[model samples]
Target: MILCDIGNTYIHFCDKYRIWKNLPTNIDKKNLQADIYYISVNPENEKKLLKAHKNSYNIAKIIELDTPYEGLGVDRKAACLGIDDGVIVDAGSAITIDIMHAGRHRGGYILPGLASYFRAYKQISPALDKQINFGISLDEIPLDTQTAISFGTLKSIVSCIKETIGGKKAYFTGGDGKFLAKFFEQSIYNEMLVFNGMQLSIERALKKYEEKK
Candidate 1:
């Protein structure tokens, strides 16, 4: 199985073995042999992916996960699928903090990701843009305006997550998840959480198929 988490910035893929790889969302598609399970947040990229798949294979089916949250992305559904109660923090182009309690999604908060924040800061203040880089030590105090922005943004995000989670399990994922994980003592990092959710969805679909027969 090939599971694809197609977001605005990157397309995260995992094969049956659970090896994950990522590519720019705008990249041209290549051929795929296995069954494709995908969750795409970008409509334009989704269209491109579907068109490319149509031209590539005949036997493999493309399955899109059905999300329960009205406006939540499929990747979030995948992250929280097996959990009866927990908080999911995905740090990519944006940071999403979603809660699942007693099988119900309690919604989440969306904020600019670290890189996105830095990029926006630079764009807004091009004079300081060249000086500010997102790669700063978590323990380091801000020595300059650029460092202050980077550290301050990260601390703000971490503080928010800490307050919301309380004592519940937390799952951290996405491009910058590992970095953010350092701030949380209990947060577990799962790069394949979304793929696992896809697999769970497949199992449910299969069970439904069997019941109909």
Candidate 2:
């Protein structure tokens, strides 16, 4: 079986052996002949995939998460499903930090991602446009302008996440997940977290179907 997580920019696919991604326009039915279970945040991409694959199932419909947060994105819900007691952090185009305990979502917040911060700085002033130095130390004050900006942005996010977690384990995923996970003492970097959640949802749906039959 194939599991797909369609984002705004890329369509990620995971099979039993490996994972890969393709642009929505680049997807070929010849490469994806197996049954696909998917969750999508991009409606246009979702429609394209649905049209191409007759065996595809949208697992978002089958997933049932215990969260009261209104208009929670399907991707966020999927990332939180696999963790019963931990802070889930997905550091993609946007950073989403969610707290889950006892199989229920307590609350969460969103923050500008690494790229977003860079963009914001660039918009404010061309001189302030600098890429984030992911390796910059948060312990000492920065002297250079680039370091100063990086320190400020990284420190704010790291400190907030640390405080919010309150010593709970953190589960990090997405493009920049590993970079952010390094700041936490108790954290895991799992690239396949959303896929794991999708697999769980698929299994649950299949079991329900069989029971009904």
Candidate 3:
């Protein structure tokens, strides 16, 4: 089976053997043979994919997660579904931090991603426009401008995450997941974390479908 996570910018596809990404418009031309189980944040792209693949199933319609946060993004839900207990951080265009314990979502928050932070700095002033110094030591006071900006941004995020999780394990995913995961000693970086949740949701959905048959 094929599992797809469609975002505004790209469609991430995962099969048993491999994973890949492509433009939303190009998905129809891939000629995939397996049924697709997907969760999408882009409705227009979702409609296009549904029309193109008759066998596609939207996991959003099938999986019911325990959460009180109204209108939580499906991508966040899918990431949280894979674990019973931990802090889940998806570092994509935006960073989402969620707390899940014993199969239930406690709550979560969102922060501007690394790129967004840099863009915001650029908007403030050209002098402030700089890339994040991922290697900067957060424990030391930065003497340089670049290090100052990086420390301020990365330190705030890391501190907040550490406080929120309170020593629990962290599960990181998405584009910058590995980078952020490095800051946490008790963290696991899995690129396929969302897909793993999608797989589990698909299994539950299939069982429900069979029961109603």
Candidate 1 per-residue lDDT over residues 1-213, each given as its tens digit: 676777887766677765654454444344366566777787776666676565322111323333455766667767777777889888888989989888778778788887776677778776656443457876778788877876777778888899998999899888889888877888899887777777787787788789999
Question: What does the lDDT read for residue 199 in candidate 3?
Answer: 84
Which residues of candidate 3, in runs, are more than 4 Å off?
25-28, 31-33, 47-55
Q: Model 2, 57-81: lDDT tens per residue?
A: 8878887789989888889998998
Clashing residue pair totals per candidate (backbone < 3 A): 0, 0, 0
Model 1 reaches what TM-score against the true structure?
A: 0.83
> For candidate 1, what is the total of clashing residue pairs?
0
Give the CA lDDT, 0 to 100, for residue 149 in model 3. Answer: 92
TM-score per prediction, in order, is: 0.83, 0.92, 0.90
Worst 10 residues of 1 by lDDT: 56-65
Ranking, lDDT, top scorer first: 2, 3, 1
* Candidate order, TM-score descending: 2, 3, 1
Better of 1 and 3 by TM-score: 3
C-alpha RMSD values across all candidates: 3.7, 1.7, 2.1
Error of 2 at 167 (Å): 1.3
lDDT over C-alpha atoms for residue 137 of model 1: 78
